[model samples]
Target: MKNLIILLLFLFVGQQNIYAQKTIKIWVVRHAEKDVSNPKDKDPDLSPLGKERAEALAKYLKGEKIDSIFSTNYKRTRLTGYPTADKTGLTIQTYDPATHSELAKNLIKNAEGKRMLIIGHSNTVQEILVAFGAQKPVKELTEDDYDYIFELTIKGDKREVKVDRYGAEHHTKE
Candidate 1:
């Protein structure tokens, strides 16, 4: 009878520890399409279609409990994350694309058990995945590809990554 009580106590404590280590969900995406009409402006903002796509992205993640939003110091990236940040009532936090490894470490530390959204460029999306210790290498997104959504789930020492599509259907030419 005493052994049975001790076993139950051990089981309860183990379950509590398991519950304490919650899984972290990180959503990654490239910035929306930019307007290249102005040649002089080095940092152009999102185009009309880009704005619409941003709105769709916000709607897609509206139900999610996004704890933080990260974007580069670029206009396009900031605009892409603005809608979601506004919806979640969280301000956009800027991160340097040059220091992706450090950013990944900080994200893992601060965003544990929380949902985070990151807006980056096509060139940097793959690097972010690699920084998070993703098993598979993500291909560089094409210039016209703005619908890719990379979902990363981190639970303890295990990490899983899945690619999804969001916003309007992008018609790629063969």
Candidate 2:
């Protein structure tokens, strides 16, 4: 009986490892809404509504097992990640905007089957999407836009891109 129990335990562990290797979910959020009204606000921070949105975003993501989080060197992106990181206990990685596409590629390579979140700007996010070969001209996402989650599913040599846009929305290029 003991031998049978040990075999069962081993099988459970093996199944878990297999699942870990099969799938990864990635959440890409445009930085929260910024205070663009202030001409003096050279470096715009999250506006009041933006802060609330961040809190809502945190609540929505609280239960997910997010393995990694990333943000631009900018304060807005870093701040946008704060709530999620605090909830998930993951530190946000800062990457340069100029080299963002390369950095994103490296991230996908290293992430393997683990989930990751990358927070970025309107322009930089476009480059990131291009790097993933998900789409071209990746559509400059803005603070006013809480677009959708870019879900990439990888199995062996096959990769698929699906967008789970907010409010079940979809985008078509002009």
Candidate 3:
């Protein structure tokens, strides 16, 4: 009876560990710099510096197990996420910027236990982070800020968020 009880306890503990191991990590960042030369163009592409920053982002996350990539339909967001998508051989999925909450819910539900990347705009990054139940209050990114990376880790019912910077330092003119 003692041995049987010990085995049962071990099985229960192992199952808990397996459940605890199921974690989902999301990497979110604002889109790289945009080319503002064409004022009439509503959707401008990334500038040269943005391209280099995108490459740097790809190199930084090269070894991460990114299973999925999400970007808005706009050119700048897609371009920012393109390098990483290309490197990981995963097609970039477009999400509607208008329905950020729904997108966040769907991603958390459907892509649970996976690592994903989301490329968004300066205004939307903080909104998405809030949707993920992030504890820290992340202010809206500035127009010229392109180096912030928000990492959201969801382990079961618990969530952890961290803000980190990547790529070269971008100096804005006063």
lDDT of each: 0.87, 0.70, 0.87
Ranking by lDDT: 1, 3, 2
Give the best candidate by TM-score: 3
* Tens digits of lDDT, candidate 1, 87-149: 889999999999988999987777778998989888889788889888644545777778888
Q: What value does the lDDT take at residue 59 in candidate 2?
A: 74
Clashes of each: 0, 0, 0
What TM-score fits each model?
0.89, 0.73, 0.91
Indicate the residue-level lDDT of 22 in model 1: 80
Cα RMSD (angstroms) for every candidate in the order listed: 2.3, 5.4, 2.1
Instruction: Look at candidate 3 and tell me the lDDT of residue 155.
Output: 74
| Model 1 per-residue lDDT at 108 | 79
Stretches of model 3 off by over 4 angstroms after superposition: 18-21, 172-174
Which candidate order results from sorting by TM-score in descending order? Answer: 3, 1, 2
lDDT of 1 at 71: 94
- Please write out the lDDT profile of model 2 over residues 1-174, one tens digit for every residue: 999999999999999877765565667767776667877866788777667666666776677788988888777788888988999888999887788778757866776768778887766665676666556333456544654556555554455666654321224533
lDDT of 3 by residue, 1-174 (tens): 999999999999999887764788999899998899999999999999999999989988989989999999999999999999889999999998878889888877877789999999888888887888776446557877798888999876688988878888886424
